[model samples]
Target: MYVLKHGIKRNPEKRWALPDRIFFGYGACAILAGAFLEHPSLEGFYGERIIPGEGFSGNHIYATNGVIAFDYHGYSAREQLLEHHKRGWASRNPGWHCTIATVDFDLLDTVELNRRKMLGPDQYLHDPVPRARRFLRRIDHAEGAARALRTVTRSQPMLRVACTSDPT
Candidate 1:
């Protein structure tokens, strides 16, 4: 506590000093300020590969907050969805130490190949009449992806259908 020293035997050198608690508060504030000033590491992070004009899987896989992530796109119209490994995955993800890594990129590459195959021999490139086989292939594939992903997520009860006849 500090008070006006009017008629007390006080030295003139250290007469006007802040309280001890106030000095300590300033010290703590300085330390917190330094911690946040440091930047996060972005040196070895791998770039994501996604192309435009490619096909969409249309299956929602993950969700966070109010955002939902559907199936990943295989190809892009502008550039390749996945590029060649100029550098290894080790360089990209330094702490990526997985013992049971079983995914093969070769199988994943089939997405673009399958899409083209479903469209048939490109017989009528100019003539847009009767492209039923190709049309059916894409439709069936999209439906299958949706159905498979739906198995993982449990749906909420129908809120608007409460008035329906079937109560079961």
Candidate 2:
């Protein structure tokens, strides 16, 4: 069984939303970043893996099912994840088969999946440049990431629910 973790961060006006499609399929272990699953048939084949880097920094433990189109806020991360998958996993897996969904936390919130629990949420909506820089600085840097992860677990919501991976 894959230990799956997925959620999005939402602060007042903005949210760091990850497309549902990113989680779909058997995710590979790219970095020592987190746990990943393997396909039964394709034993050696691992899915696309992109570690949080310079301009991007949102770490999520993936396993899943489903697809969705991109909107403005989620476009960058979505594009990066998709492009990697297209070049790697798609060619290897042929018919990529899997399904992924997020647990509904706040009915009022727009993003279905709340990832604040894992990578923490992005609070700088208005200041995009600062947010991007911070994401790179903190998430990419070892010392900064350790400090940030501590904050994420400490500030997590009271009641956190988890969902299983549905490898459709």
Candidate 3:
């Protein structure tokens, strides 16, 4: 029975920033999804995720472009994403059943914007557009790093094979 906390206030003049792990969950998903919409291939969804047997439920906003789904967990195949959640939760709670119902992206975005306006001027929460952009940049940078690592690792086996095959 998770619920959104409202009326949290912050100093209007103070500079506010999102935590490093902001991509992990909650409203941050919404912001990230919104930002991801900039990519024409992606569509954002507001998902109401619930595990009825375990009495656990939450909202998980994410972006998917037919083939890939992206969220706090990063990129996954569109088909495997929800299944992955189910497996993870089921492991913790025997007989766990999870389901996600999607709502319109616009509706969720509007609601989030309204809620932020109600909350005082905490720059991190008050204005999501720029925050989302910054978050997207971080994601891109991380993806680049991961790709580079994978490339290096893949070449290692080849390098070892070449060294072993050579005779002095």
Error of 2 at 94 (Å): 1.5
Q: Residue pairs in steric clash, candidate 3?
A: none
> How many clashing residue pairs appear in each of the predictions shown?
5, 9, 0
Candidate 3 or 2, higher TM-score: 3
Number of the candidate with higher lDDT, 1 or 2? 2
Q: Model 2: runs farther than 4 Å from truth?
A: 1-76, 103-168
For candidate 3, report its TM-score.
0.50
Question: How do the predictions measure up, each by TM-score?
Answer: 0.15, 0.21, 0.50
Which whole-number lDDT from 0 to 100 does residue 41 have in model 3?
35
Off by over 4 Å in 1: 1-100, 104-139, 155-168
Using TM-score, rank the candidates from best to worst: 3, 2, 1
TM-score result, candidate 1: 0.15
Worst ten-residue run, lDDT, model 3? 159-168
lDDT of 1 by residue, 71-126 (tens): 12211111111111111222443432222111122211235324423211122122
Whole-model lDDT, candidate 2? 0.28
